[model samples]
Target chain A: MSPVLVVLDLMGIFVFAISGALVAVRKELDVFGVLVLAGTTGLGGGFLRDVLIGATPPAALEDWRYLLVPVVAGLVTFWYHPTVGRLERQVGVLDAFGLALFCVVGALKSVEYGLGPLPAALMGMVSAIGGGMVRDLLAGRVPAVFRSELYATPALAGAAIAVLLDRLDQPYAVSALLGASVCLAWRLLAMWRHWQAPMPSGPASV
Target chain B: MSPVLVVLDLMGIFVFAISGALVAVRKELDVFGVLVLAGTTGLGGGFLRDVLIGATPPAALEDWRYLLVPVVAGLVTFWYHPTVGRLERQVGVLDAFGLALFCVVGALKSVEYGLGPLPAALMGMVSAIGGGMVRDLLAGRVPAVFRSELYATPALAGAAIAVLLDRLDQPYAVSALLGASVCLAWRLLAMWRHWQAPMPSGPASV
Candidate 1:
């Protein structure tokens, strides 16, 4: 991995961790709960992908820095939650970058592990959204991806693009860049436009 | 696996899946959601344990029977939810049986995959409770495991016993039976005795 990519990846994890910490603080969870939420929200998607693809001792678990980023983020939010909560929009934008990078990287990894293109793409989306799902579950809420604005579709599209390009022998950097751009642009646009996923039509059967 | 164990495993999945389906119906989720919840509730724990242990393309995914069981269970609950809901007590009992089988099977599998005893035992508990956690999450609730009476502890104890017995060179049948019995008995006793886990004292800081 290039230095730039590595930096972006870490930044993504950092922002995602902060989001988790903010949620924990809002819920009044203790220090341990806050740290756990931060770590899972930062790294849960990759852990899900790695475990599914038989990558034992997930990369996050093997690397100390991965563990450190979330803890620090959690503590920062725990102490300065008011300021952090006020900066939700900025944090959300950074989270979009994280989502984009994770989608492409996750898709590429699954493809390299011999999963079919569709499954790989699905895995990519999972990599991008799985952490938030875990965080929401732990916080006792429905996952935002299920009802939030156009989040998963963009992720799926980006992953599909990356997997397809990689399978066609495209350079990793090119595939990643194009895929990340698509996801990032779509996500930012959705946020700006206030796009929403369709909810169930009519009264649901009781 | 022996024929008997295979049957027990399937039964466990069936009961767990039914419980998930019931939750979905009560939540007024559509048929698709009901099926999804059933499958995840039945199989999520094993998936978690397998993925963590680097067992890719989880056993439930590879086997058609594994996929079929949950779908069938979901359909059954969807069509007869009124009757099934009334039989909640009976279902709870069956669920205890499922939990017992899952913990032992999960721990034994992890130990076979070269996990440390403690981690293997933890994985076992995960396998038993994980599906319900996923079910609760999808249904937009906190998981029962964190607050439920004498649930995870029994699962862990059962798993520890199985792992320890296996390490001591006991036959697989002997190890599994003792572990399952211990778990089943404890769980049934808890339900019968109205046991509750200790909750935090004092007012939570908001």
Candidate 2:
């Protein structure tokens, strides 16, 4: 990976890890729980995508830095959860940035590994959302994305845009920037507007 | 994979999917949720292991049969849930069978992928428990294995035994059978005796 991509990936992981740790703290989980949630949220999406694409032992497993970032984030959250909880808005913005970066990177990587456009885009969304889902599961809650604001749709759209641009012979830098911007902009808009995904119209039958 | 192994694998998937669908039904999730849970429970463990081992597109994605089995299982449970729910004891027995089959198969597959014995055994336990964890997460519950009976430990033991026998040049059939039997027997004993894993000794710190 290029230096810029690597930097963005690590930043994304850091932000996601912090979010996971915050959730763990709120749930009154132990320090071990905080660390585990951090690690899972930071790396779970990439791990899922890589495993699906046959990338074994994932980059997180191969590099100490990747593992270290989450630990640091977890410890920070553990020690300063009150402050972190107070800064929810800022964290939400950072999470949007992370989501944008993950979607584009995940799509491009899937394409590199020979996935078709549809599957690549889906993988991108998965890469953006899978970690959060795992985190919520470990934290004993329904995943926020499944019931919250427009999150996955933006990720999928960004991924699709990236894949389309790449297929149209756009430079990697151009495609990635445009794709990430699309996701980031859409996510921010959803947050600002308090947009929600559609829910089941009727009561769920038992 | 051999025909017998394939059959066994399908059977395991069927049982796991049934369990997942049952959870969804009890949770009053929509039909979509039922199918999603079934698919996740049937395939989640292998997906995790395969990703770690660098096996891409996972067997479920590669073969139609693998995908078909879970869908069938989900539909069955969804339509016949009252009957299926009433058959909880029988279902529990079948779940033990599925767990036993998965631990051995998962361990052997990890070994084939050149993992060390310890990792292979761990992977086996993961393969046996991963799906149920996913199911619980989707159903908005903590995973039962983390706090319930001696589920994961038995899987680890069976997987370890399989790996050890394989190292000793035991025939694959012999190793697999013995390993599966160990898991099945232990799981049954745990169920019959109402055995539980140890939990945290005190209240979780806030």
lDDT string for model 2 (B1-206, tens) is 89999998999999999889888777665555676689889998998888778677776755667878998998888777877778888888999999999999999999999999999999999999999997887888878898877899889889999999999999999999999999999999999998998777889999
TM-score of chain B of each: 0.98, 0.97
Structure candidate 2, residue pairs in collision: A51-B51, A54-B56, A56-B54
lDDT of 2: 0.88
Looking at model 1, the pairs that clash are none
Tell me the lDDT of model 1 at B55. Answer: 81
Model 2: per-residue lDDT, tens digit, A1-206? 88888888999999999999999999999999999999999999998888798766788899898999999999999999999999989999999999999999999998898877777887898899989988998887877775567888889899999999999999999998999999999999999999875433333334
Off by over 4 Å in 2: A1-44, A47-101, A114-122, A134-142, A153-206, B24-40, B51-90, B114-122, B134-142, B146-171, B177-206
Isolated chain A TM-score, each model: 0.97, 0.98
* Residue B152 miss distance in model 1 (angstroms): 13
Per-model DockQ: 0.19, 0.19
